[model samples]
Target: MTESGRKLILSYYVSIDGKSVGPTNGMRGVMESIDDEAQEDEYVRQLWEAGAFLMGRASYDAMKGFWPVAEHPSAAPMNAIPKVVFSRTLDSVEEWGASSIASGDLAEEIARLKAEPGKDLFAIAGDSFQRALIAAGVVDEYRLWVLPAAAGTGTALFPEQDGPLRLR
Candidate 1:
């Protein structure tokens, strides 16, 4: 956590061209190509330090299908940490143990989570969900894994905005 208190950290992997999406082929291809064990270890450490995992509906759906069955180094932490998925459409999230759904106002929900006593809240959502958070100006820190390749044409990590962001 930062000096201010527990932070909202958004982590993502992006190509050199600023695309969070994988190569022209797809995410599997790019994911399989990554060979950085050090970075992987660091990511696992971050997960272990997180008080909870925050994500959008789509991300929750995607992860629910994989993490529960994945037998990877990070699976333990991924399954262990509490998760909050923001979605008005989701009626229930019982399948994912230690998880809940937040359908209230985005910023307010994040504020409520921040007020809780614990380590930092980490977000693991795609660009659309991140765009909403960015526009709300609720994110405290960004952890971008700048991959070594170019995606050519894919979704941008950050959406277009009217003003520039001042980062420390």
Candidate 2:
């Protein structure tokens, strides 16, 4: 947990070059080629521990289409855990199970969620949303799965910072 009494965890799959565009071109193949069952299990365990998922419009859109239909080992927890999609344009999120739309101030909304009694919040969003969170200095921990290959061209996971962030 953070000083706010709730941990904000940012988890993502990045390339060796730090690109975070999901499974584009040959990236998915590269990621799958690495046979690491233990690591995969640990990642799934972490996902199961999250109290809720935080996502942007893009990730929420993509996940809503896929996770609802996909038959995978992580599907159960992925569907069970509550999700919050931060989008100003979206009026509602009924299609995505256990989800709600957050159209208000991002920081305030997150703070409210943090104050509530729950497990750590897991963040998985598009670059723009993630950039906003990083700029706000709200994330408590970063959990990245660095793949073996490069994405060639895509969004960088971390944006330019005004100052260095010290991590323990």
Candidate 3:
């Protein structure tokens, strides 16, 4: 948990090629492509359980188009959480849901959130943001969901590595 009354957690879904498939495996993909409604419901439920959510500008824009009218069971929860977006040009978060702009420095903001009284802040997408947090040694945990498939090559999840990481 964070000191400012929030917890920072990063969540990601990766393919065999290490690509973050937002367009394909993202919101639209889950709603239109996936055949399982139960899976979507469960994902939303889990997403909502978090006290807050953070995402990059790109991811936030993509979500703005889909999550509003989404009828999945998790929609209610997703619509309720406090959303924080990282962006410079976005004047205000006027999306259907309640959202706020990142106020402080990334690491500082995250630390304050971690100290807050909450379950954990969910880091929703933002590959670059995740990498920065990991490199900064601020990310406490890394939960990478390895999907059951493989792509020969494309946008990779692990773009650049400064050092070798020992993972269990």
- Per-model clash counts, in order, read 0, 0, 15
| lDDT per residue as tens, model 2, 78-155 | 888999999999988888789998888989988888888889999976778887887787888888888888888777
Instruction: Please give the distance, in angstroms, between residue 135's alpha carbon in candidate 2 and its true position after superposition.
Output: 1.3
What's the TM for model 3? 0.77
lDDT of 2 at 47: 90
Off by over 4 Å in 2: 23-25, 162-168
TM-score of each: 0.90, 0.90, 0.77
Residue 90, model 2: Cα distance from true site in angstroms: 1.0
**Global fold similarity of model 2 (TM-score):** 0.90
Collision pairs in model 1: none
Model 1 quality (TM-score) = 0.90
Model 3 / residue 81 / CA error / Å: 1.0
Cα misplacement distance, residue 166 of candidate 3 (Å): 5.9
List per-prediction Cα lDDT, in the order shown.
0.84, 0.83, 0.69
Order candidates by lDDT, high to low.
1, 2, 3
Evaluated against the true structure, the overall lDDT of model 1 is 0.84
